[model samples]
Target: MIDMLVNLYELPDSSELYQRLEEQGIILRRANAYERHIVADWVGAHFSPKWVSEVKVAFSRQPITCFIATREKEVLGFACIETTAKGFYGPTGVGEDARGTGIGKALLFRSMEALKDNGYVYGVIGGVGPREFYQKTIGAIEIPNSDPGIYRDILPD
Candidate 1:
């Protein structure tokens, strides 16, 4: 995987994406501090323990850097910014059943918007999985030689 860079100032308006999700009964918003355990557990079950750790860090922030997609009070997806590092967007995942519902894209936009609100001109999509998705969605450009960037070192599950 490689890291990608996004120009926060150039982010496309997300109203349409958000509205689309709304029509499907999906709600995207920042994770509340009180929901820390629930969200962390959800991430662990749906993604990874490593991501659960990052989710905890996101909850620690004053404004909570994590955003979640939910419907009928059920978690569909999640995105975290400034978790592993500042100006970094990641550790996100949508439940397998929730794929193709635009949850991921909406979460991405919400995270990017939060990064912009945090006074960052550029945001890094650290350790990208689907390179094409990032490139196509937010105009993210690949960072040369970024494979394993900040993801090095050995640790076991």
Candidate 2:
């Protein structure tokens, strides 16, 4: 197994990640759902603040985990991990520019490790990218998109 190492920064440490990200000119951040412009700009998508506002509210009701990635002291990527009631990794990302370079795998591994540490022995990647990456990089299984998510697990022996 390719266990990728990632430094888990608390919400406060997020500032450091943002600072580093700013230096690299990567404008990604773990903003609240109400912050749509920030996310739009980060994803290069034309979205309205209304979407951000709506999502923020939805996020509060659901299990949402967010994080930012920095390269050389600049924000390179941001991710949102929305967990299912059954404990799955959902809605993950490694910014467009930050794709490859093992960032996705690193992010996925870090998130899964964290989940595992928290007693979640399983995870799923939902509404994300590169299906092959999930399987090849972390040995995740590709279930039918019945739940429309990439479900993977580290079961307790």
TM-score of each: 0.98, 0.52
Candidate 2 is scored at a TM of: 0.52
Scanning candidate 2 in windows of ten residues, the lowest lDDT window is 3-12
Q: Residue 60, candidate 1: how far off, in angstroms?
A: 0.7
What is the C-alpha local distance difference test score of candidate 2?
Answer: 0.46
lDDT, residue 130, model 1 = 96
Per-residue lDDT, model 2, residue 131, is 62
Weakest ten-residue segment in model 1 by summed lDDT: 147-156
Query: How does residue 114 of candidate 1 score in lDDT?
Result: 89
Give every collision pair in model 1: none
